[model samples]
Target: MELSQEEILARLAAISQGTAVEAMKITITEAFKDRVVATMPIEDQHRQIVGYLHGGVSVLLAETVASVASVLNIDIDRQLAFGLEINANHVRPKKDGVVRAIATPLHLGRTTHVWDIKIVDEQERLICVSRCTVAVVEKPAS
Candidate 1:
């Protein structure tokens, strides 16, 4: 099943309610199996002591985009996606600006998915590079 961009945003917004992603003001700009893109603003709340974008925050944004992309590729009614593992390298820091994270699949398997996420500042400078692995699990009976 395929969803329109607006539909994807609505779904992502629902998932983000009251979560850290919502606090970071993440906006889903593009959503598809081939690629997913999101943006987050660098604010005081997201900064570390040195006043730069927190490395953890970059990893959070990375996982969010990659995990959501994994979810988008699965059967929503029967399966759910969860982060199995993730790693990030913060190449640069942002003091104040919006950072965009683009996630593209490296492997989409029956039970697992791997994504490569590249985060860039508003000026298109690389901020972080991340790889995320997601496990696709059968939804528990509820």
Candidate 2:
């Protein structure tokens, strides 16, 4: 059976417990079969030595959204998705407040999925653009 939107979001949240997603305070705001959105506040921990948002954090957020979206597309009972590769371009610097990541599928094949992710600040200015490839594999029996 297909899960409801709320149920999918709850499952995503549950899987994120005690992970970097939780530590970074990333919240999955909107989730759909084809798209996913998340937001993270820029706190001290998210900043680099010069106090700008860390580029790695942007990449992390990008991969997180894309991977979660991939999981939603596959059969969780039989398939597992893992990020295979990712690339990002940082366009703007952010110091504080929240940034949102929106992810959409570029390619969804039986073995792999590619996602385009955009990170924007509160003003809707582009902060980072990323593409992530997720590998889908059969789940090993427990």
Candidate 3:
């Protein structure tokens, strides 16, 4: 049977425990086979020395959404998805408030998935744009 959206979101939340996604306070707001969305607040931990949003945090959020979206597309019982590579361009500086990230698949292949993720601030202005590649492989025996 197919899982409901709430079930999927709950599973995603459970899977994020103790990970960077949890530590960074990134919340997955939407999840689907074709898309995923998440949000993070720009707190002190998310800022660089000059108090601007850290580039690495943005990349992390981008990759997190992409990887989660890939998991949603694959059979978790038999497959595992991991980020292979990601590139991001930080466009605007954000000091405070939440940043929303929207991720959509560019390519969903047998072994890999590519996602385009856009991070926008409260005003919906672009803060970062990223493309992430995730590798889907058979789950290893426990």
Candidate 4:
């Protein structure tokens, strides 16, 4: 069964309270089969020395949304999802403004999944584009 949106948001909230996500101030806004969305506010901690939002922070947001969406598609009792590869292209730079990331599946397979993530500033200008590949593995024996 697919996870409810509330459950997904709760999971994201829990994750954001953890190490890196908390530092980046990421909050998941929406999640479902077709799309997963998150937002991160621009803060001093999220900026590069020159004041632009850090590229790695964009990639982190992309990977987080893509990975969560892929994991949501799997049957947790039998399989687990792990990110295999990811690539990001930073398009525009922003010094201040919240950024939102939207992730959509390019492919959803039995053993692998591919997702495309787009990060945009509050004005909707593209900031980064990312792709993530996830591998579905059988659950390990406890």
Candidate 5:
């Protein structure tokens, strides 16, 4: 069954309420057509052995932000997108700073979605970038 626009919006709001991604304190700063923005403060727990922010954290941010956008763009009833392919490139290292990730829909098709994800620091320097492909699948009956 295809979801109404209001249903989709309600689902998004419900997911935002207790999202596991929220554990990272990833705040949605802005959202618009085909795009969404999320921000996080990099702390020691997110750092690597060398005191630089963990590379995995960057990847996680990219995936989370991209997933959020793709989810909102798709049919919200039974269909859902699962990560198919994701590639990340880290440009700079940081230990303590505010990091923001912006995800934009590159392509949204019936079976798949592609997103371009970018992360920037407090100084507005690009810290990480990624391209993600999510496979749209049917949600199982409850």
Candidate 6:
């Protein structure tokens, strides 16, 4: 079931309180699916010595979205998803413009799920692409 925004916030609130763990925050500014568009505009700090966006950040955005999508089907306590593998390909680099990534569901299996992420920029240039695989784990008894 899709969680209400309030419920999502409340659940994430617990993660933020330190009793739980959540790696990424689904901010209100983020969009999803077709409406999903994100831009991490390049800054001097983000740039490499050659003046290109750090390649690591590009992969981070892709995996972050994939992990977020994987959590949609997960339970609070019993079962959680964790990354098993991630493969990223850097097609090109941009030093001045914004960088964005979009994740699409590649497969959702009983025990595994995969997502194909495509990263682009404000000018609609391909930056990086990645595939993330997550494994579903059944937690031990409390």
lDDT of every model, 2 decimals: 0.92, 0.96, 0.95, 0.88, 0.82, 0.67
Better of 5 and 6 by lDDT: 5
RMSD of each: 1.2, 0.9, 0.8, 1.6, 3.5, 4.3
Superposition TM-score, candidate 5 onto the true structure: 0.85
Output the lDDT of residue 25, model 6: 25
- Candidate 2 lDDT by residue in tens digits, 33-135: 6989999999999999999999999999999999999988999889999999999999999999999999999999999999999999999999999999999
Tens digits of per-residue lDDT for model 6 on 1-142? 7666567556544654532123322232243432233446676766678888777767666766676667765664788788888989989878776677777778888788788888887777788989989787888787
Clashing pairs in 5: none
Score candidate 3 by TM-score against the native: 0.97
Model 5 spans with C-alpha error above 4 angstroms:
1-19
Query: lDDT tens digits, residues 38-67, model 1?
Result: 999888999999899999999999999998
RMSD of candidate 5 to true structure, Å: 3.5
Question: Candidate 4: deviation at residue 139, Å?
Answer: 1.7
Q: Estimate each model's TM-score.
A: 0.95, 0.97, 0.97, 0.91, 0.85, 0.73
Which pairs of residues have clashing backbones in candidate 4? none
Residue by residue across 48-111, what tens digits does model 3's lDDT show?
9999999999999999999999988898899999999999999999999999999999999999
* Candidate 2: segments with Cα more than 4 A from true spot: none
Worst 10 residues of 1 by lDDT: 1-10
- List of clashing residue pairs for candidate 3: none
Tell me the tens digit of each residue's lDDT in model 4 across 1-142: 5567788799778866857777788888888877989999999988999999989888888988987788778887889888899999998989998999999999999999999999998878999999999899999999
